[model samples]
Target: MPDTPPEFSESADSDAVAEDNEFDSLRGILADGVVGAAGGLVGTAMMTVVFLIAQSVGAFELTDFAILMELLGLSEVVPPVLFGFLLFLGGGMVPWPLLFASLKAYLPGESSPVSGAFFGAAMWSGFVLAFYTGQTGLSLVLYGILTLVAHVVYGIGLGAVFDYFETRPDSIV
Candidate 1:
């Protein structure tokens, strides 16, 4: 009786809506992952610089990268310093933001600077401190103080960058 078939029209409309929803979901995931990765990389970079500066200034004499490689018995390849930087980039820089993003839903407090600082402290105490202490026999008092400060700085940088990108008018996440 009508020019359009009823079944075909209904199915097509439903399909279009379904497709749109799927696309939106995928877009949200991509946006969040990209923004989080960017934030993590930047934060790690800042942390590395601060640590290096402190090391040069004779704050403490320990190399996390070297200790990690030695602990894993991988120090024979190239040099420990080179491998340490690579490990720091891959292990340290890449994971923080991703972990933060994954745990964003459960992270206490709003995603503000204070919250970021707290997150950084948690990360240092929970992960970094333990690792260094076990692997390198780090001085709990000295190394802990340095790492706590550095991790807090890193967290602040990560949070600031993520907030900036997330709040942009065209941000998709």
Candidate 2:
């Protein structure tokens, strides 16, 4: 009151609040990215288990990397298996996770896991359409079933990770 007008003081206070809100928004974005990446790691690992089992049981021969290799035309230039796997892993950790985090709020489900499953299933449609493996008969059916199951497992794992982080006392988001 002595040094500054009331209006000026009010303006300063509002400015400070606005700055804090901006910071909080940025922080929330970072938190979502980090959490989503972590969830992706877990989700990818779970998906890999299903794939390995399915491969062993002769359900299908294609891995995530295999499809990626063909799609990217890297099979001839690089060691397809190793390079493709690395690419797949990197993709799982970043883009997919970020996308999942962005869409989580809008997805339908009673819980995080359920929502994640829906997300995975939705993603599956893309995979089936974009990366058709050309299987037929029993193998095709098994491939469809097994891949769907794998995706659901992946989503469950991802959502579980999100749930775990969200419930923590010092949760970022």
Candidate 3:
């Protein structure tokens, strides 16, 4: 075995580094985008829920809620909790699963946390902003922080568990 050229080894190392960097950068972007969308969905759900409850209890003007709902082609009043959960699940888990699955195809060797932290954080961000829109409250900060953490944990945990299951010997992403 003749001595390998230094240039050959250096080039190979650079290629590996570049590849890793690209992979990380892509994952980061995907993670961020998924989180953002999830947050938005949660916020929207929260707002809609509030509107429904307000209408039912007369806390929010019926005319306004009705008009909004009618415009959206929704004719039914929905439970706030249902909306909240939908928003939470949609924001916290929807994107991650898709993102994780897509990433698996490209980066099967990459590490993705099972906890739903990513979506949680992102959804929480949107939730905070939406909740605080044109309003001030003492619990705003607390709710915001809690929302973020809850969503993130859910997202990360879900991811971890998902990955765990997917890691079975015969599993395929």
Backbone collisions counted per model: 0, 0, 19
Q: lDDT per residue, candidate 1, 28-87, as tens digits?
A: 778777777777777778777767765665554446567667766888875886686677
Better of 1 and 3 by lDDT: 1
lDDT of 2 by residue, 97-155 (tens): 77877888999997889998998888788766554567788877877888898888889
Candidate 2 local lDDT, residue 89: 69
Stretch of 10 with least lDDT, candidate 2: 58-67
lDDT of candidate 2 vs native?
A: 0.79
TM-score of each: 0.71, 0.79, 0.43
Model 3 lDDT tens row, 27-97: 65575455445534443444445445443543333232233334345536664444544543463345545
Q: CA lDDT, every prediction?
A: 0.69, 0.79, 0.47
Native-vs-model 1 lDDT? 0.69
RMSD (Cα, Å) of model 3 = 10.1
Which segments of model 3 are wrong by more than 4 Å?
A: 1-96, 103-110, 114-116, 131-137
Please identify model 2 stretches exceeding 4 Å from their true place: 1-28, 62-64
TM-score of 3: 0.43
